[model samples]
Target chain A: MPKEKKIRVLIAKVGCDIHERGALTLLTTFRDEGMEAIYTGRYQTPKGVANAAVSEDVDVIALSDHTGSLPIIAEAVLAELKKLGVTDMPIIAGGLLTQEDVKVLERMGVTGNYGPGTPMDVILTHIRNVAC
Target chain B: MEVFLHNLTGIPRVDEAISLMKARNIRGLTRAISIVENYEEGRDALLNDAFQRASEACFTLGFTGAPGVGKSTLVNAVIRHYRRSGKTVGVMAVDPTSPFSGGAVLGDRIRMQEHNPDNGVYIRSLASRKALGGLSEATKYALYLYKAFGFDVIIVETLGVGQDEIDVARYVDVTTVLLVPGYGDTIQMAKAGIMEIADLFVINKSDRPGADLLKKQVQNILYMKAEKERPPVLNTIADQNEGIDDVMEAIAEVRQRKALQGQERHRKRIVEEIRSSVLTRLAGDAEPHLDEMAGKVLTLSMTPIEAAELIIRRIQKGCLEDDEKNSI
Candidate 1:
């Protein structure tokens, strides 16, 4: 019998801010849920994230940015994704996104907007929904 | 088909494969590690075949310390040192389990973002989830697999707070215990467990106040236990990469000493492994019947003590055949 291939995810935190609690939390959550997640650490640029996504060939790219600069970073990341021809890959954004910000991020092609106190299961379910 | 053949043969064409690994070929190393880690599934044959083909160029180091001790920073320093020497390093950082979510809080990887560009270094963050020893039991297996894949150094950074973290020392040739100054009574809490296993003690954040005093205290404790062979202690500020060279040198020295002292620690490690294995197996065997037994006990069909006795007896009877085989 052939073993099932695990879902691969790339969890990256973009922008100059050093806060990575959300990203780390997501990485661990994915692993515990039996998913293969490649963590890009913290303080990554949009290009770095896009490059990693292309190299890793991850099913999902989860961006965790706690710094209030998500609107700009999301736009840059979406632009990079489009440029790299990776628009098919789901880009989920979490961490400190307000309702209005979420709406804006969605328009920019973000798949999910996760805020503080959001359950990891919710993120996992969302990834499964989008990637599977 | 090539991967399958590689798995069957247990031999890595070391020069070619290691060069591939050193060039940041993550896919190659990842595949090789999977093969080696699953040795019981007959990948050992392939690894043995690869063994003659691979270089004997690997060092395995274990890092453990309390939370907020700047272990990630120290690990970053260590990675930078190895990178400067043109050696490929694999870091496996084990993070604490999130109590709320039953997942890992992989915060350590976030703190060491600068090293991402160094293609020679592969940093993996692992969550310690319900694993008794604080490390994923597969970690030692993973380390050896990395070695087989030709990583020059594999650093296992573990969650530093519990018994599981201390168990990490048994698996590595050198274990460094990281500490920070003025951690208050947290030092006292960890002293008994961590002090015993540390191959070397590192006082990181040396720029902070009380660093010297903390070092003195640790030194004094080691002095008191000098009868049992004390590990050397050093101070470093990992954020700035201070004193990392000295730490690495000390680690190398310890590795050499262990090589010379070979099998002494290995035998002890085997004994510990046996103990843990037996307990885990016993638990697995007992768990399924636990609810049934509890129901019986609740109904007064059997006392709680009697239920436990029955479980032990069953285990004993089950092992009797193996015990006889051993005797014969």
Candidate 2:
């Protein structure tokens, strides 16, 4: 019998960001939504995130940007994922984003750009929609 | 990396996976562990193949005790000590699975943040999924995977449930059961199954008042048994990073002692694994009969052991048939 697969998400803090309050807080939020969430602790590089994402076999990679490092970090992480032959693993951005930033990130192949204080219910719904 | 080329499609390539694992590719090891953990097709065969081909000689160290003993904190301390000597460490920290959500919080990763950036240390957190032993049943397989990943030391940390205390002994070469001062009933816990299996007994949080008493109780328990080289009982305040050196030395001593025993203890562990595997399979097969059996036990009509025997007899007579044990 084929066992049912659970949605596994990698909640990570990318770049040299120390503002992990959002990332740490979202750990249980994802788990409560019936998703297996693995947190990447502080000081994560894009290469490390890409490696951990591939190694952990996570379905979604959500990057929490505390600094303004997401644009470059996202591009580097996407390149690293490409190195591993991953093209469409939904790379989502959360926390402290503006409309202009969202437009730029979406144009650069990021699937979702969510802002701070976005309800977990809405976030999980979007993840389920894109992930499934 | 070349070995992972086999499982592009179809069933998981057990042989190629073994090759990739032997060469210590993190991606291959991670994917293979996922397959076994999820109980995908041929999971047991893959694990058996890898067990035979890759990791028959890796040393496993187990850390377990009752909850609130700072097991994770102590694990972080030991991992740091090992890494100082240029040894690679792989940690498997198990936490309880959420019954409502079926996902684990996995808080151990936060405590082990120091090793996150260290390439020499690899940490994987597992949820104790439906295994009565209070461990992810595939933990032993994870140990093998980590061993094959070029780690010099593999540590398996249980959720500290009493049921899983003996389970760690099946896989590890050395076991350290951590206790704290003023642990309510330390002496009573010293009489548990976990204490008997320990190669090193640790009194963590030794800064507290009852630390010496706990040590005395553990010593008394050790004295009751006959032994050649007695298992050392030591004190440590792991959170403060005090006494970690003595703990490491005790582990080294125990490793040497286990090596001296050779295959004698290994043979016994295999026997225990076989028995445990068989009984778990039997119970799984007789699941439909369990409610009635429980009712009989409640009514005092049959003992649990009798019920087990009856299940075994039924299985032997072809009355119950189930899948093979995929619990590593």
Candidate 3:
């Protein structure tokens, strides 16, 4: 039997930041592009996000961060995934990132680090490419 | 034709998954559900083996109703209640798959995020893909796997349903239908399909006006049934956790009554599972010939009825030939 491959994404927001208009927009965009996107909701801990990704068996983990804790939250989530022996899972971040935060995500091997005003098409294409 | 008990051969992942499931590994449950959800190769083998190991220790609860009835919110409250007692829960939240894109946005988990990383609570979102009955086709198989994994409670939260989408009742041990105040009047309560399936009725958002009126309407609807057979109607403000304890108590009472007829439920579920599996297999086998037959009909070589009959005859003949070959 052949299975239909869907790009399953876990879209989430880390601690204390409830600015979700951007994340919700991106989630809808992913759905429009025919991806199975699930948002774990706001104020999620790194551990919660990591566990949800593994349990949902999502292809990519997209974080919607706005509290300037992108690097910290991304690192913790990556570490938690590592604890579950999930090392190569694709991690992406968007919202409220400075140049330094983007560089930090790059060093940590996170893909598609986008800030506000970045084109939705660019984010979508990058996600499709990485997930595939 | 073959012995349908167990066929773990040619599927190495099943071996690993079974072992993981034995240890209650979350990843194993996740992988097992994915295999069944996608109908991947060896899905039946996995499900068959899971059935053999599955136990009746878990209580399967179903929550279904129209949109925005606070089903997920109520489920969240129930999960907290169960977690406080140190019981393990496995939740499957069903949302509709987009008919055009064949994709879905599973937002149910957003409501249950507080339970994450608890290990005692596992919540998975399912897309109601191609299943018009407010459930995924793999739901029954997923329940078997969850049972094998030894959860104390298994909850299936269905997509917001209309009148006739009551398939969830067939698969669960207890079905709780949620309704908010002002949802409908007495006529809607007396309707046949969704109202008849519930073992319990929940008027969530009971803090709103008309809550008492809805409860009275439900009681009037249940007035015809035997007192023992009547499902209890309870009020709840799920977000603030008001009245959840009463709802839980009503559920326990209903579950006790439901347990008495467990064998009947099991028999019905067996028939349904087999019937659906055979239909799905036959459909898959017949799918490859559809385009050719449609083309023949388009060219006026055959009528639509004749085209369908031809396909059926071919499939029947093919089945006989395969049987003969196996016998030889």
Best by TM-score: 3
Cα-based TM-score, every candidate: 0.70, 0.81, 0.93
lDDT of 1 by residue, B1-328 (tens): 0111021111235444444444545544554444432223444444554445544457778888788888888998888888787887778787665555454445565566676544566666555544556575545455655665667788899876743357788877788988788854535734567768888899999999998888888887677655435787899988887898999898887787668666787687668766765665587678767998999999999999999999988878878978999999
Tens-place lDDT per residue, model 3, B1-328, is 1101111222227667777777667777787888888877778888988999998888999999998899999999999998888888989999888888887899998888898777678888888777867888877679899889878899999999999988899888999999999988999988889999999999999989999999999999899999999999999999999999999999999999988899999899889888877776777778888999999999999999998899999999999999999999
The candidate that achieves the highest DockQ relative to the unseen native structure: 3
lDDT of 3 by residue, A40-84 (tens): 999998889987987787888998888899999999999888777
Docking class of 1: incorrect
Q: If both were scored by TM-score, which would come out higher, candidate 2 or candidate 3? A: 3
RMSD list, candidates in order: 7.3, 5.1, 4.8
For model 1 the TM-score comes to 0.70
Would you give the TM-score of chain B in model 3? 0.91
Model 1 chain B weakest lDDT span, ten residues long: B1-10
DockQ of each: 0.16, 0.34, 0.47
